[model samples]
Target chain A: MDMRRLVGGNFARLRQAKGLTQEDVEARSGFSQQYISGLERGQRNPTIITLYELAQALGVSHVELITPQNDET
Target chain B: MDMRRLVGGNFARLRQAKGLTQEDVEARSGFSQQYISGLERGQRNPTIITLYELAQALGVSHVELITPQNDET
Candidate 1:
């Protein structure tokens, strides 16, 4: 599987689980909406700090953003 | 707290815990020795794919590389 897609899909699922929109994530993460959108679409390869900020914004562990779910495991 | 330092420190610690040197990590992850050294020194902001590969090389979950230890938590 594409690692970027795995990360992007996981990130999107976590954000949606918390009922957050991309705009909300952008606001909380201080990343641009375009950046977050690109991330969710698997068009970006985020740095560790970016992942950290996004996890903080989603109120989840940073691991959650990168780890595949049980189905994928 | 510097997120880069936190990640770098955690990565180094995890690699050490596994008794794997930088060379070992480079060999296992297929990342360059310079890249691994830079990452361990907190001088590199690695992409998610890099982190994923490193975590695999360390035989641990990717989250372990980025998460702060209990002392910092």
Candidate 2:
């Protein structure tokens, strides 16, 4: 699987599901909004630590950030 | 959330559940057995790409490598 795209799709979906903007995720994860935006576009290669931080920001398990949801990426 | 330890525990569990050794994963994932050992011991930090490769070697999704299962870790 394409980890970058998969994580991008899942991150976008999860963040949206939580009614959070990239800026909100940035505030919560200590990651910049630009980084979040890039990740959503599958343009960033995030490590597991980044995934964990983002997942926590979205109020979800880290697993959710990497799982391929139905018809999403 | 210590991502390194979490991935380590999950990876070890998944690998063992598949009845495969570190050497087996090494051969399949092209990651060294020594590296796999360190990772399983929570001593290594793996990128998302590494997680994906290890997951593929274990015949599972990348998410499986990061998921926290019951009574593990």
TM-score of each: 0.81, 0.88
List the candidate 1 regions with Cα displacement exceeding 4 Å. none
Task: Write candidate 2's Cα lDDT for A1-73 as tens digits.
Answer: 6778888888898889889989988877788999888898988778888777777788888877887778754
What's the distance in Å from true for residue B69, model 1?
A: 1.6
**Best TM-score among the predictions, by candidate number:** 2
Clashing pairs in model 1?
none
lDDT by residue (B1-73, candidate 2, tens digit) is 7788888888888889989999998887788999999998999877788788878888987777787767643
Candidate 2 Cα RMSD after full superposition onto the native fold (Å): 1.9
Give lDDT tens digits, candidate 1, residues B1-73. Answer: 4667877888889888889888988877778889878877889888888777777878887767777788877
Error of 1 at B22 (Å): 2.1
